[model samples]
Target: MAQYSGFKQLLIYAVSMFIIALSFYQWDMSQRKQEERIHETQELRKQPLRETCAGDKETFKHRLEDVRNNELANLIVDDKHGIIYCYIPKVACTNWKRVMFSLTKDEPYPDPASISPDLVHLPNILPFLNSFPRSEIKAKLKHYTKFLYVRDPFVRLFSAYRNKFQEHNEYFYQRYGRHILRLYANQPDPPQSLKEANASGMRVSFQNFIQYLLDPLTERNEPFDPHWRQMQRLCLPCLIKYDFVGHQETLQQDASQLLKILMLQDNIQFPPSYENMTTPAFLLDWFSAVPLEDRRKLYELYEQDFRMFGYKRPRELLDG
Candidate 1:
């Protein structure tokens, strides 16, 4: 009886030890896999910027002109973290700015999403790199882990249109919609006056917007709105050595890597994207409304952006 009892005790002890060992092995593998994921994502984010600098030297030279101008104004500076972000409208600029606010200020918000979008853009809430003297701006640009996010040009254009035109955004419709209507509407002089235009509820069509964009004279009279402007022109990616370049396509992964690189993951999270806003189907539907010639012209207008960012011409916009 004593021998039987001893054998039973030994078996139980052996099984417990085996279970513990298995748990440790599983944990170690999990940790390693997570580390590998982070490393891969980091590499994916950095590859394009590396390729751009090496392969596109002449284009970089042309973009270098922006460095002479007060391009620092485009950047939102987080001096504490030694980070700088160039805010590009419609490319998650609001959330990026919101993250900046949380990073810079002590006022606690549980996460970036808790902050209102309107409040994020309020001047003086965040410090800008351009606010500093020219010499200081040069120093920060050289040392900071500067970054920016960009999206597909046509997709971004569509997002801007939907947000500004499709919705009941009176501000854009009044300011830009009327101007576009006056210029591109088939019926010449649709509204006799600005008040009449507003009262008539004149909205800029996607086609009208594209026509306005293709007109060289339009940009000469009034510069491109930052919303639809080329990211290359807006961010001056060539002039500045961005430590990380993120794409809006892989936003969650890229943003996760960014927070990890900055070591801020524990404190704040990037805002969730509006998936319904810029899907592949949404882009195809909108582009279908635009004629092929106009589509090609639109591509030509943003060709530098296409080549710089390594984005292929979206097949939806290509001639069949």
Candidate 2:
């Protein structure tokens, strides 16, 4: 009877070991399938961009001449991974810039969160597509895994205004904010300095910023500040065939899929996003300051961006 008990214990141990091995094999298979699904989903995100670019030949006619220095300046390149990210301002670009900087380091990349925001934006920190010769630029554009993120044109505009004008951003306040105040705020004698402007409680309203955008002189004077420039103009979606087109609205999922597509899901993680991101719900209050005529005209200005990036026209604001 004692010998029979010892045999039973041995049998139980063997069964337990077999179950553990089987579970590990199943887990490994599940991980691989999940990775494949992520890659497939990432590819699906580019379909809309392809369809839009193919149909929009009229916009492409001038692409050759339009591919200027400024146009290529935002295309941050990661040669190690063969990735080119066309970053649009106010479109989670800060975090993307951090990621680009982290890629430039040696193996065992530091966390993107560890990089300073100011350092990432410094032009010297990252190599842009424009810095390369025309031949190399063309080669990289063709061979690299190019990607860009877009946002609702108006919402992005509002966010830019709120950040630059509403907040105490001295650089923007000096360059564009002052001009906006002087031109549209009916303040011919606007304050000369941000400190003075803030001290007196003089601020550029959302309506004033919209007026500046609609004004012909704005672009004629110079390209719209990248912060407020149309995503189409900045990224030139028609000029380049981006493998992935992410939207700011779905940033977390899109960023995740993109990392998986690049096979960096295990190596790096996207930085945590802010909770109070701009939303469509806030449009009504913001647009309350904007007149209907100006709103329609503004929509016309960015109509191409709306169509190309699959952003629905805000009928409520435009119609009303």
Candidate 3:
């Protein structure tokens, strides 16, 4: 009886161990399948961009002439990674700059998120491609993994407006807002209103902001701020064969794929995004404030951007 009882106990213990082993095997297989799917999706996202670069050598060279001054100055070079990123403002540029800083520093930071946005844009922190000789710049452009992120033109404009005008950005209010008021508010001494605006913490209205943008003199005197500048002009996508073209809309997935392509997944990850400003409701709320005539003009101004990036005009803006 004692022997029979011991056999039964041993059999039960053996069966439990076997079941546990089978469960682990299934989990491991599932994990492998999930990783494979992610890899496949990443490749699918990059396939078209890779194809776009295959036959465009002459066209890229022809478009390089238009890349003078600021456009050239904007490229942040990572020689170690052979990467050149054109930082377009209001398109998660601050975070991108932080990532670049991490990639190129003599001793890379383990956490890019810890770097302040202020520190990222310090003039000497990262070297610009333009700082290099023209020959060297050309070589990097040809062979480097060039990438830029673009947002919808109108959405980007709204973001700029919010960041610069709607928020308590003293520099922008003093520099651009004062000028905007002087030009559009029809007030010679708009300081009182400006003072009130500051004290009251009021946002610059979309209509008034539109007036500032549409004024021809604004561009004649100075180039549009990079925040609202057309992405085509800023990044010169036509001239540069970007190995990756990420969008602000699909930033996480696109950035993850980009990191995988660069083989930086183990070393660094794209910082967690804090804001998603491109939601349909958020867009509708802002566009509702913009008048029809102004909206049409804004669209006309950015028509090239729309075509270049293959973004359709938002139906809400048109219908509103």
Candidate 4:
């Protein structure tokens, strides 16, 4: 829920959000309407156009006010509805995908790995999403509701480094253009640009990126400073909060609310056992390999996230 002050403020905020959602949602609807109007106008343009079976009295009628009257005629982009599962590395993002896209044909739902060349940036997450030619995205905006699963940056980055890089083939690194896979426990500085990382084969997995941030001595043989201290010190919670800002700790509740808003309950089922995971909790691994100083840094970076979503960081536990 949005933070609001007076009744008037709440009303204004609610209206604004509604209007924003409506404006974008109505794009596909408006585009379809425009197309129909254009065709109708064209027919009128040729006032004395060719005579059909009955010339304007062809025994055909359309009820413009009702969708039931028009929808069956293929007048809507209903199936074109979509949801963006911008999968941030790790966190409990996997659980979200399972609840949202699992059990509906084809494995690996909400694959962030699916980030294609065309959909590289957020602006291009969907066609016509960059503001112009807004019809496609606009028309289907209502039909589509976007969903993103984010995690604490450090935790997420660490996991991404493991599963995406250490566990799998060096494909993502290749996507960013890193020739060599990477070594165990090796963390290097975050790359400046894809070009820079690709140029030096530093396009490692997100986890590897985490390692780089934690271990300053990475590839110590070379002078590796990525310029921006923030970039070099990027944390998971910070990365997630930068976007639409959802809660990983409250993932089920948040996701369920989203599903209810989108009216996708029938198609998607909120799982009773979302807690099921292939691996143990992250704190265990952090205590073993991650040093106290680095863990402290992670806690500090993600402290706000913990407080906002009501989660106790493992800092105290690790301390003792």
The best-first sequence of candidates by TM-score reads: 2, 1, 3, 4
Best by TM-score: 2
Taking all chains together, the TM-score of candidate 4 against the true structure is 0.39
Tens digits of per-residue lDDT for model 4 on 179-279? Answer: 22234324344444445555565545433454455554643644322121222122222211221234465566655555655556556655443452423
Say which prediction, candidate 1 or candidate 3, comes out ahead on TM-score. Answer: 1
Instruction: Report residue 235 deviation for candidate 3 (angstroms).
Output: 0.4
lDDT pick, better of 1 and 2: 2
Candidate 3 residue runs with Cα over 4 Å from true position: 1-61, 106-108, 192-196, 200-203
Q: Encode model 1's per-residue lDDT on 1-320: one tens digit a residue.
A: 99999999999999999999999999999978987887776566556656776787766643433465555557899888899999889888998998998887674545788889999888788888878877788788888998899888778888898888777676676678777887888655666554566577766789999998999997898778888988877887767877777888888888987887888888788999866456778677878888889989899898877766768877766764
TM-score, prediction 2: 0.87
Query: Best candidate, lDDT-wise?
Result: 2
Off by over 4 Å in 1: 1-36, 61-66, 107-110, 190-201
Weakest 10 consecutive residues of candidate 1 by summed lDDT: 61-70
Whole-model lDDT, model 3: 0.78
User: How large is the C-alpha RMSD of every model relative to the true structure?
Assistant: 3.8, 2.9, 5.2, 23.0
lDDT of 2 at 109: 94
CA lDDT of 234 in candidate 1? 84
What lDDT score is found at residue 79 in candidate 1?
Answer: 88
